[model samples]
Target: MQHPAVPELAHTHTRPIHWVATATAIAGVVALSSLLQPKPATAAQSATPDAKPAPTTAPSTADVDFPLDCGPEQALVVKKATGDLDGDGTPETVAVVHCDAPMGTPPDGVYVLTHNPGHTHARVVATLIDPKARNTVTGLTVTDGAVLATLLGYSTADVPSCCPDVKDSARWQWKDNTFVRSTPAGARSI
Candidate 1:
């Protein structure tokens, strides 16, 4: 056979030591690249220093002590809706709360809650329905900065608490620094 012009290469045959050295070099490159990543990119600019930060989150109902005397039972939130009710940029929460009764129907109390951006606790701004009225909220919603509710009430004191004899649809709007309540129509007997 004719003599080859070039000699055989040593790396053509990979030994255990060659594999170990190659693995170490690859690991080193990966570790070095991870430590040299670029900063994250953003599209929006930062806010001005003096302007008030827009409130992002609506107030929560937890830890809010509603104006209701449950006696031995605690106040429980059944339904809630959030919206900007007072024409303010920040949103407010409307909560329907009632006593945690084990037996009969308990009257519900509807309250409006507002919390400043940095405040720790949310305060009650308005009480739409008091528990003393003995009314149960069948449906509640906040739409177009208005609080609308379907209320179930009694026609007279003789009516039993278990059965409400009157059904009314009520709407409350913020006007003149107070919530003005107006009924779309007269209460109907159920």
Candidate 2:
């Protein structure tokens, strides 16, 4: 067959049109192959059989005791008792302690104790100053299934001033073995 002598016709008509489609198909195959391949094993899992097992540390026992001094005064009384603060099946002992002198001043007064379960040991969870003052814990009342402790006063050192607000009340729970600060959210291990 006789072909045209024009340079444009000779060059344009010779190249394959399927090159772009072939490149696209090759790219798809490469991507699919990579995705189908299995991942290499992690170093720890692939270690030699003779490697020694990692040593385990014992759990801490910090939560076992309550903070004796709410601020500066020492704990005067630690009355042991049990109740379900959260209404859970587990009953925790409540430590109702009285601080002899004011946390910072002389005649350090009474304070309540609650438990923190997260800690290994029990500790004093919260302290309530005299009930006469504003933002104070009035009393400790345990009903059919609920445990309520009134906030008598705020500790300048121990508790935050804006406590017992609508959303937050100064309360404690018995967890692990110590008293902890109780909040509407839950008991905070001291």
Q: Give the alpha-carbon lDDT of every model.
A: 0.91, 0.45
Model 2: per-residue Cα lDDT over 18-96, one tens digit each: 6777788999999999889887767757558885443232222233443444466444543333455544444444444
- In model 1, what is the error at residue 84, expressed in angstroms? 0.4
Task: Name the runs in model 2 displaced over 4 angstroms.
Answer: 1-64, 70-73, 78-81, 102-136, 154-190
Per-candidate TM equals: 0.70, 0.29
| Number of the top-ranking candidate, with lDDT as the measure | 1
Report the C-alpha displacement of residue 181, candidate 2, in angstroms: 11
lDDT of 1 by residue, 29-114 (tens): 99999999997878956678876677767899988878999999999999999999988788999999999999998999999999
lDDT of 2 at 144: 45
Local lDDT at 134 for model 1: 94
Candidate 1 residue runs with Cα over 4 Å from true position: 1-52, 116-118
